[model samples]
Target chain A: MASVRNLLVFRQLFHKETSTYTYLLACKQTMKAVLIDPVLDCVERDLKLLRELGVQLVYGINTHVHADHITGTGKLKQALPDCKSVLGSKSGGRADIFVDQSERLKFGNLMLECRSTPGHTNGCTTFVLHDRAMAFTGDALLVRGCGRTDFQQGSPSTLYESVHSQILSLPKHYKLYPAHDYKGFSVTTVEEELAHNTRLTKSKEEFIKIMDNLNLPYPKRIDESLPANLICGVTDPVSS
Target chain B: MASVRNLLVFRQLFHKETSTYTYLLACKQTMKAVLIDPVLDCVERDLKLLRELGVQLVYGINTHVHADHITGTGKLKQALPDCKSVLGSKSGGRADIFVDQSERLKFGNLMLECRSTPGHTNGCTTFVLHDRAMAFTGDALLVRGCGRTDFQQGSPSTLYESVHSQILSLPKHYKLYPAHDYKGFSVTTVEEELAHNTRLTKSKEEFIKIMDNLNLPYPKRIDESLPANLICGVTDPVSS
Candidate 1:
């Protein structure tokens, strides 16, 4: 186990337009970094911040193929020659690296254990940094709210199982960072979610009914976001 | 000094309408808590979170008398009978407790050292929790930006000196949490602000010039917010 010396450099960046969160994490000692769920519109801002922090970008990883905004991973690769675009193997999104369940991705001295947490989408993955007790849960589990399992191969039963097994099962104190938050909440703990998650705390059948009854409007940007995201947000849609 | 055992329980709550950040800090061992810069619009949400956390409300502190939005201190005091409304002595606002520069306010086992960082507003203050290397900079220093010094006794020269002497003087790695963020930035470090703060990084003259030329529109809520905030956001305007 690593000593409690605070070896990780972390920053949470937000995209106001889509209410998306992009995280930048770097290994302090090696200056190797990864950007989780970067947005296409804020790549310049993210890049400037990365440069100011003086960290080298190793990977631009997305938690899933988003339905609201395009990913910045492709544009990031174009800017950072050494950066790779990463996504879950089941995500069906083209990327430089396709991570699978239980795969451990390494950067500097830090290791991210990727847990396949599908149901919000089959490719939704939560990256857990066990040493720090932090998990970047894409849309599988949100603060007090879980993702809508209404589109893109979403299944309420599967999402419920994935969250309970892969995310909620983590240590209670683990800090969970979600992909998007409309409210002003920045982070939530597994402990808090366990006690307060509006939907997931109910019986599985109740959860299914709740998911089914959500009368949400179709995502406004779905048409544009889905296609662009599938090709890793590149206009030309070419694999690296 | 306390041992490094992660003793403080922290949560950053946001008000979307005003772009205000209300921070909740609690002593894990004592279960005593304080909310810094709470917004009037989110009192229900804040109270619910406090109840869920199982912490006793010690103080509801505002960093200043805001013009953009009303403070939640008054409403919080009404909701949490034991909670006191707190503000800077210079704020000229009615509050249960008036703190001044260099005063240490205690909540359970945690101590917040108050530093007056005026210029954004005469009463604008920054609360530093030295043990955790965290500073709640209320509208004084922002991420790559500083509060506009053009209203309510706002002086560019004073703001520059206040920031350089009080906030920027903190340890370089100390995380700075601002009261409001228009952009999606949640927090910044002292080091980053020193290096990249567009206004503060410049000379006093340049900063003054920048502040002078910034033809920002009049604050829409100032007329309503100023009067209500002066009495700590109570419609009745009575101090507890």
Candidate 2:
């Protein structure tokens, strides 16, 4: 007999070249699955795992139009014809489904509440699994650091508010999974981030000043990534 | 208002330089924790996380003495004076507690059943958290792959037997976490691996042949890692 208490099937995958984290989540009973932030280079790997798990890929969801690696949603749709490509409407990216703020996306017996968290990008959204007390934070809130606010419609003040109001206000113990982590941390809690987020924990004025002074070099792949991502990562010229 | 059903607190940490994974598991009620496969370079990071989580470190266990990276168990013992260093007795490594086959180590409300699954190394052991239906496979088994059998007393036949008899025999749904993954996979299931493990799925004779012909290059850090690990990864000349 299967246990009803633990019905969420979850796996965390990585793309080493880009330091991206792709998540596979499914409802144990129905095996209906969703892939959050899949990477273009890992489409085959993702497809193989999905097949092995025997889960039906209902949605290939991206948290935002990534500036690093191209999104795998388009490729995933090609592999699984029934799977829909999903993105935030504000992202200015094409998708089969453009979700709005506070929208509920259901797969199997689980529901994910989409919250717009646009500090990283206008379309950046955090998907919250309320019952599981987990949030797929994308770039809004990393383990101890938030995303850079220098590009892709980024704003320090806007990001600051988005994180505090949309993410931190959740229960202190809620697990936050980020899109990318260079330090190897897989997950963090709202409580830990509230206490130690190097950038976001500071006053808004200080945070703005810090983000302003970062002066980091432009992302190496932004030009290619942004355009590719706008089309939902479809590389084939004939179809995309 | 704490939920009694979800008393286990878990985190999967990674060390990018070596592609190693360190896991933190604790009993929520008692706040007693154990770290599996900690790396020397990430000691400070691990300690800070432990302090922030407000959990007392009880045991620092190593799945095996790694050839790729030095274990952080000794450094952890130095920082958390109450925490004991644990390793398999067959591993021939010095530790505060040398667990034997079928030994159960208790930390708060949880117990890990250590099963000797040596093929990657004589001391390799897989720790199974029975309640959670998960196993931490050191190097004997990996995601669709197994550890290289070119050196460090590696024997493909022994590994095949260990994986098939000891690890694979667990319930099919049991999740298996490996000590290291180069391709960005974090977890797999007994069923998935049984169907997909490239090397172990082969017959013992074929598996041995494949391993023998791997012709892999010598591990770059093995010379330094082995000696340091034998002493539990403590580099200080005075205390060690």
- Highest DockQ against the true fold, candidate: 2
For model 2, the local distance difference test gives 0.91
What TM-score against the true fold does each predicted structure earn?
A: 0.97, 0.95
Task: List where candidate 1 sits over 4 angstroms from the true fold.
Answer: A1-5, A237-240, B1-5, B237-240
Interface RMSD for candidate number 2? 1.0
Put down candidate 1 lDDT per residue, A1-240, tens digits, no spaces.
656358898988888888899999999889999999999999999899889999999999999999999999888988997998889999988988999999999989998999999999999999999988999999999889999999999999999999999999999999999998888788999999999999999999999999999988999999999988997876663654
Over 4 Å off, model 2: A1-5, A237-240, B1-5
How many backbone clashes does every candidate have?
0, 0
lDDT tens digits, residue span B1-240, model 1: 657348799998888777888999999989999999898888888889899999999999999999999888878887877998888898888888888899999998889999999899889889999989999999899889888878888989999999999999999989999998877788999999999898999999999999989999899899999998998876663544
Scoring only the second chain, what is candidate 1's TM-score?
A: 0.96
lDDT tens digits by residue: candidate 2, A59-171: 99999999988999888888888999899999999999999899999999898999999988999999999988999999999999989999999999999999999999999
CA lDDT of each prediction against the hidden true structure: 0.91, 0.91
* Residue B113, candidate 1: C-alpha displacement in angstroms: 0.2
In terms of TM-score, which candidate is strongest? 1
TM-score (2 decimals) of chain A in model 2: 0.97
